[model samples]
Target chain A: MRALSRETTALTLLLAPVTLFLAIFFLIPLGIMAVYSLLEPGLYGGVEWSFYHWNYGRILGWADGFIEEFDIVYLQVLGRSMGLAALTVISTLLICFPVAFWISRLPAKQKNFFIFLITLPFFTSMIVRLYAWVLILRDSGFANQLLEWLGLISEPLDLMFTGTAVIIGMVYIFIPFMFLPIYSSIEKLDMSLVQASQDLGASPFTTFRRIVLPSVMPGVIAGCILVFIPSLGNFVVPDLLGGARVVMIGNLVEQQFLYARNWPFGAALSMVIIAVMMLLMAVYLFRVVKADSNR
Target chain B: MNRSLGKTLLTGYGWLFFLFLYAPVALIVIYSFNANPINVMTWKGFTWDWYVGLFGGATTVSESSLYVDSTDQLLDALLTSLKVAFSATVIATVMGTCAALAMARYRFRFKGFYQALLFVPMVMPDIVLGIALLIFFVGAGISLGSTSIVIGHCTFLTSYVFIVVSARLAGMNPLVEAASADLGANEWVTFRRITLPLILPGVIGGALLSFIISMDDLVITYFISGVDSTTLPVYILSMIRRGIKPEINAIATLMLLFSIAIAAAGIYFKSRNTAQ
Candidate 1:
């Protein structure tokens, strides 16, 4: 009895705090946020205790003839966020394809150095990085001043506070997230397989399409999902670089809780974002499971 | 000749890719020493005046630029960040390491359930996580402050530490522990003399990484932070909302250097563990 009690005590001491802390802070909060989404947004702030689907209805554009007639405003922001995420993923893959291949081809010593250089920026804060673009892209900024000096354009272009600027910032931020995974798969790639394919008389483009592309598709998909997920919820980039002219789901959530003080509505917006993420995760999980079962 | 052509093409593409990656950071370093304090692009003259102005409270051009975020407040925010990072790192490291060890060394009931639940923090969007935590705190009647920020941080950070430490544990051979037990050592004794020393690298690496993440955090901290508990990143976000200033560039440059050093140290420790 004493030994059994002691073993239980040891296990409890080791695991209980983490379990309890997560339950209280993580699980409980997620549950509450979900619950709040189902409740009405109070007149001023806080929430109404009565059960309400109106918050979700407004965000999802299925508002049940309640006060507002199916506002598409929030839906547009969600679409914008999704569009930006898709663009960031595509652009990153295009830029990274050549780089990933090149890095994998490097001599062992140089390979580590190049990988380090790529990932070093990722360790820094996103806010600071986005601010750097502000310096470069702002009117009277570096690009404009240089163009003026070279007589490239008569007037400084309206570069900042635009959708183009937001995409540029997000792609810059996300490229590494795309690069490293693809590089990992590329590094581990068997060069002999490609050489064999070539010996079998396949052209370079054909070899890439039939062999190299198929092999690294997993990493490519992984990178896309990684970039897409964060960029979708990315509040900082659109808020700082894109300015008020651009409002994504992240910004709308921020306005609700921080600016508008509408907790219920904020919770609803959060649910929509979570739903999109969960849908993506379900697809990702399905793929992983299918691949594992096939193997 | 075809091979050479390919090599040159690749080299050119590689340089552009690297330049794209480092351009933003490189510009910050250059503009921190820029002459024009407000407009970071236009160079009036080279001066260490921003560096001076940061400490002594004066700009390169004028005494009162009005929009220059107070360096004193920035420093205060830095301290708050340091304090929060220190607390969250310590707590998360202990809980996460313990969980890592338990999950690795022992078989227990409900292990699969615990495993899935732990990773919820990593995959969940920060925006959703932040709002959820905020609503949670309000619902629970816990006043928002440094404590809330630390809680929010710990929620995610513990999982990160768990991952790092668990990777270390996974690679480690279980026979060492079996050998220690065969010599008549108790569980505590074996863990202390054998297991703990082996996994110390993971613990240290996880601690360092968690500290950096806690500091780098903005979205979670922003929602949970009170006026008195504004972290450096949160402060920077607010400053940018107001307007651009060169002092921010200077501070950002310093933070970049600081994070690189810490991350380099963490990688070193992580690599050292894998080598063994």
Candidate 2:
């Protein structure tokens, strides 16, 4: 009984610091945001005392039976956010899987080098890389110059500040993130099973579909989540590459709190995004746990 | 023959993927040497102009040149970034290691709850955390500056440190602890001598991870950083918005090389470990 009490004391004492730090700095701020979402906008900087659901109503376009009062602009923004995130997840998965599979197939001595190369770019500051892409994709940039030099086009292509540019940037930077997880999964796969399937007269495609894909599905799901969540909330690519032409959920939330001074609305939008993220986490954890149970 | 053909195709595909990956970073490194006083597209003859300009060396600027930062301001921003990163990493690594010990060594009630709470900071959107912290600080009447930046960073970084250290702890040999107890060492003494030493590598790895994350962080630092506390990324971000100069490219290349050297060392160690 005494030893158990001592253990509990040690645990409490040890856990206290992080718990307190997180509570004060992280949890309290989020708690404040939760409350702020319901409160009306302040005259200047803070939220007013009165309760208001108008902020969320405005975001979700809940018209109080008045058709003209409705605006689905932010909802569409939310849709765009989802669409872009899904696009990033799917494309990154498709591209990185082949890359991961290739790396996994390499001779054992060389495999680490290939994996390391994929992730090295992720260590560099993204702002610098994106700026470099601007140098490549801008008017009179490398792409345009090359095209013109090749006699493929008479004029410089206007590629910068386009949605395509944002997607391109997202895919490029997110490749390692998607690749590493998938690579780790495939690297650990029972290759003998793959060989067995091949030796049983199964076609390559049939072998891959039955053995390879199922074995690496965990990594694929993980890669998809890793890419999808950040892409959904990404403000940098859209802000820098998309310029003013495109706006995602992150950008809109930033605008509200900073420029528009609509704290409640911004808080509401964030809460919604946070809710969506929480739901995704729950789904992912549930799926992973179920997979673990089956195994 | 078919297997060899397949291997060749896979190697080609790997090269293509890598080319796509490294092109932008390589462009920055290459162009940093170009004496393109104007746009980077117009590649002037190779010169040490930009690197010299990044240092305190004198540069002859034409009338048409955009604004340039002196080494003083750029160094100030770099120092601030280093300071914030170091301070945040220390705090997160210390507190996180302690909490990780608790989780690893004891069976506590509401363990999952605390774990989830820590993870929320990691997975939550930076924008959400940025604005949320902004409003929180503003409401709390805490002035936005270096101190707030440290706290803001610690909030999210603690989670990462916790994850890294706890993973190490979970894999640790339990018999070592039993041996320490059998030897009649007190709890604190055993922890100091055995557990802490055992987890030191994890602590260092977590610290490095935290340091990089803190340095790379822009959005949270941007929202919270005051006029005097602008970090390197923030300064560079502002510069890019106005216009990027070749000197900025030089600085970026240097930063890239620094990180690349560190990554190379990490990869060497990682591969050695895997081989063992």
Candidate 3:
């Protein structure tokens, strides 16, 4: 018992700096944001503590101010954001799944180098990656040039600053993220189980569906969370590639704080984003835990 | 009945995926050799002029003056980025390793909460964290600049290093340490000699990961950075705003090669260590 106490005391001493650091820098700032979200901004860019209003509530459609020009515009924005995030996830998965499966099947000698190639681009500036997409998707850019060269189109297509461009950019940036987790899962799967399924008269697709998919489902779920969360909150890709025409939830929050100077409203938007993310994380964790226990 | 066919299909799918991943990067590298900087897509002809120009004289060679032109600004931003990433990685690594050791060795009540709290920066939207930190700094009367950005990065990156180190510690049996102690070493000495060595590789890996993340980070750096404190990504963002540059492509291609080289080295060393 004394030894345990000594060990714990030593541990506490070790953790003290980091604990204080997080408490001051992380939790405290988040708390301040939460507090700032509650108060209304005053006449001269100052927050008035007394003006208790739920301007944020109007956005979620949980409350109407009962007198002002409140509407469901925020809800529409939320819907738009969720739709974009969902599309990003679906596209990323579509591109990444086959890639991950293919990479995992490589001879052990060549596998690391293959993974290395996939991950190499990620180390470059993400803004550059998105900008490259801009360079490609622009009307007079590479995509158009290639099409024109192949005699496919007489005129350059108006591809930039659209929803499709944003999705493509998101997929380009995040496919590696999705690929790694699924690849890891696939690599870890028991080969004997797969062989057994084949021997038991299961076709390749059936074996994949019943045996392979189940084993890799955790990775798939993780990949989904990894892709979805960032894609949902991503401000850069849409801002640059989509030309700020598309209103993602991330952009909405940025506008509130920086451009609109609506601190409380931005805070509310952020809180909604946080709440949704937390809820999704909770469901994911629950599913993962359930899956783990069953395994 | 169809194992060979299945294998063939999987192989095809894999190569196709690799092609997709590599094509853009390859395109960027290839296009850097174009004679015309503005026409990146339609290659007129290949030329070594750009590479020569990169070193020879100036970013802007005015017809009047030859000596005044410079790539100094871009070079400065790249250097600043390296400094910030290195600083953030080192600070985060040390603090994070300590925190991980604490969590691993201790039977603390709030350990789970601590673990969850560490994940906030990594999982939270960068823009929000950036703004929250911006507000916090403003409220605290701390001046905004590179230091604030570094502190913000360290806050989250420390968590990353901590998580990585903790996982390593957990996977590492405690019995080795106990045996070391039984052989008559103090806690500090034991950690220095045995524990730290065992976890050093993980610590280095975590540090490298943090360095890459800090270097790649845009959102937080954008909000926190002062007018003069632009990292390479922030610089690239500003440049993109101005318009595309062939030099930017050249810079990107160089950066790409640097990253790939580092990643390859990391993989090589990591595998070599495991093979032993």
Candidate 4:
């Protein structure tokens, strides 16, 4: 009985601090934000204590037409954000899948070295990486200078402040996030299965479709989730590279808090983002559970 | 012949991929030394004026006027970043290590729930967490400043430390603890003498990672930081928004070196632990 009591005491001592800290800082803050989303915005900068559903109604097209009118811009921005994030996912998967395969086939020493090279950029400052893109894509930037020197064109291409620039920046910064998972999955791939498929007179495309794609689907899904979540909420890339042209949902949330001072409305926008994130996580979890059951 | 040709094509593509990853960074490093005052992209004679100007030293290039009003604000931001990173890292490492130990060694009813709960902060969208913390602080009457940033950081950083320490603890054998108990050592002694030394490398690694992440964190800090408590990354961000200057390249190069050095050290410790 004494020993059991002592063990329990130790466990309590170990668990208490994190539980308390997270409860006060993490869970309570989210709960309060959720509550604030349903509160009325004051005339100036603060929120009123009265209940208000118009904050979300403004986004979802239920505005009463007296005080708040439904603006389609918010929904458009949300859709654009999702669309850009999906494009980033597809681009990163295409860029990383072949490279992951190439790296997996390398000898052990070179493989580790290449993996180190891939992960090294992730440790660098994100702002610095984004700034590099600004230098490359600006009107008086490297790409324009190089093209002019090559006598290809007299005019500078409008690369910066475009959706293409934003996508490139997103893909550059998120390569490691996508690469590591795909590489791990590729490393575990069985070469003999590919050989057997080929021996059975399957075409190269057919073999890849039959054997390789199924094996790496989990990693692709994991990588997509990892890349898509951050891309969906990104403001910095669009701010620097997209300029004022491409506005994402994250920038909208920022404007609501910093410029508009509509705290309740900002809270509402955040709740929508949380909703999307939760939905994606639920889908991913369900797929994983199903995969495990099948196994 | 077809297979060999395919292999060669794959090898070339792989190298090009790496070049795409690194060339932009290389451009920044090289251009920081260029003496072009108006356009940073154009190549001019090499000079160390930008690097010299970053430290408040006088530069010979009169055309490249310094964009920063004063270097003191930059130094102040750096100091704030270090202070926040240090305090947050210490608190997070302790709490996370303790939590990892409890989860690994004990059979608790909410074990699965706690594990999932920890992942929520990590996977939550940064903007959502930022706004949530912003609302919470204002509503709770907690002022926005270094204290709030530290608290905000710990909410997520503790999860990172927990993961690293938990990985270390998972690879360890519990029989050693049992052996220590059999030899009449109390739990405290066993933990101090047996477990801590074994996990010291991981603890150090986790601390280093949290410190780097805390220093680099901008999104959450942007929403919660007080007017005077700007961090280094946030400072750089504001500078970029204002205008591009040669000094930014110098600062960025230095930051890149610092981050790489710390990450290399963390990887070294991790590799050494694995080798053992």
Top TM-score model = 4
Off by over 4 Å in 4: none
lDDT of 1 at B88: 99
Q: What is candidate 4's lDDT per residue for A160-252, written digit by digit as tens? A: 998889899999999998999999989989999999999999999999999998888888889999999999998889989988899999999
Top-scoring candidate (DockQ):
4
Off by over 4 Å in 3: A1-5, A62-68, A202-206, B1-3, B47-56, B59-70
DockQ, in order, for the candidates?
Answer: 0.77, 0.77, 0.63, 0.83
Taking the tens digit of each residue's C-alpha lDDT, what string does model 1 give over A1-295? 9977777788888899899999999998999899998887788887779998888778777776756456888889999999988998999999998998998888988988898888777778878888889888888888898888999998999998888888999999888889988998887778899999999999999999998986787788889888998899989988877888988889999998988998888888888888888898888778865785787
> 1 or 3, which is superior by lDDT?
1
* Poorest stretch of ten by lDDT in candidate 3 chain B: B59-68
Q: State the local distance difference test value for candidate 3.
A: 0.80
Chain A TM-scores of each predicted structure, in the order given, are 0.94, 0.94, 0.93, 0.97
The global Cα lDDT (0 to 1) of model 1 is: 0.86
From the highest TM-score down, the ranking of the candidates is 4, 1, 2, 3
Per-prediction interface RMSD in Å: 1.2, 1.1, 1.5, 0.9
Q: Relative to the unseen true structure, what is the C-alpha lDDT of residue A136 in candidate 3, on a scale of 0 to 100?
A: 84
- The DockQ-based order of candidates, best leading, equals 4, 1, 2, 3
TM-scores of the models, in the order given: 0.96, 0.95, 0.92, 0.98
Most lDDT-accurate candidate: 4
Q: For candidate 3, lDDT tens digit of each residue in A1-295?
A: 9978878778878888888888998889889888887787766555778554476666755565663335677788688778888898888788788777777777876887788777876766687677677768888789999899999999999898888888888888898778888889988999899999999999889999999999999998888888888888888888877776777888888887777887777777888888888999999889897889977
DockQ of 4: 0.83
